[model samples]
Target: MNDNSEIQDVELAVSRWLRIGVIISAAVIVIGLILLFIHGGSGYPDDYYPHSLSEIYSGTITLKPYAVITTGLILLILTPVLRVAISIWVFVREGDKLYVIITSIVLAILIISFILGKA
Candidate 1:
């Protein structure tokens, strides 16, 4: 009904969305970790290309599980990084110090996870 109330509503909505994002990101990282473990922790296999560029040229590319898992892990890492970057952009545009702080923390956590995943 009032300006302050509208701002509170918007803030509440943003907070809820951020919480959901964090949960989803955590889930993705967990899933990626599981896949990495299940697939022997190797990033990718070179054998998926059928041993030559000519094979790919011939439209014969075998999809290796290792390669797929590695790609999935990379995607999982990149998704949260992109989300944090977007959040940072929005915070900057809106001049919201709290959101900037929160997003920065999230970004740091994602970076840590990526590093650990690599290890």
Candidate 2:
């Protein structure tokens, strides 16, 4: 195959992935809204601290169903959006793919940490 064909295939693949990501993102946003409504809204007061790290590590933290679900939904929506932006920036400038990959990984880890911490 010619270089042009290869490039076209890559572009098509990327487009397909982007479309899937968008659909998933929309679904996550809907779920997040549903959770926000079910959980009594997004803005929690300072006194609403639900868990201590020690208790969480000890597996004693009382996990609130709504909070965990809402947090996961929010992360699901945000992570892909962030990844796409970073990926586009990197791809456009022909920057290092490693940077994009590392950024995505770090964001994922942070999201997981936040979810676990809140739970």
Q: Please report how far candidate 2 places residue 88 from its true position, in Å.
A: 12
Candidate 1: clashing residue pairs, number: 0
For model 1, the superposed segments whose C-alpha errors exceed 4 Å read 1-65
In candidate 1 the C-alpha lDDT for residue 88 amounts to 86
Superposed on all Cα atoms, model 1 deviates from the true structure by an RMSD in Å of 8.7
Off by over 4 Å in 2: 43-119
| lDDT per residue (tens digit) for residues 21-81 in model 2 | 6676566556656656776644345446335444322321233333444444555566555
lDDT (Cα, 0-100) at 95 in candidate 1:
91
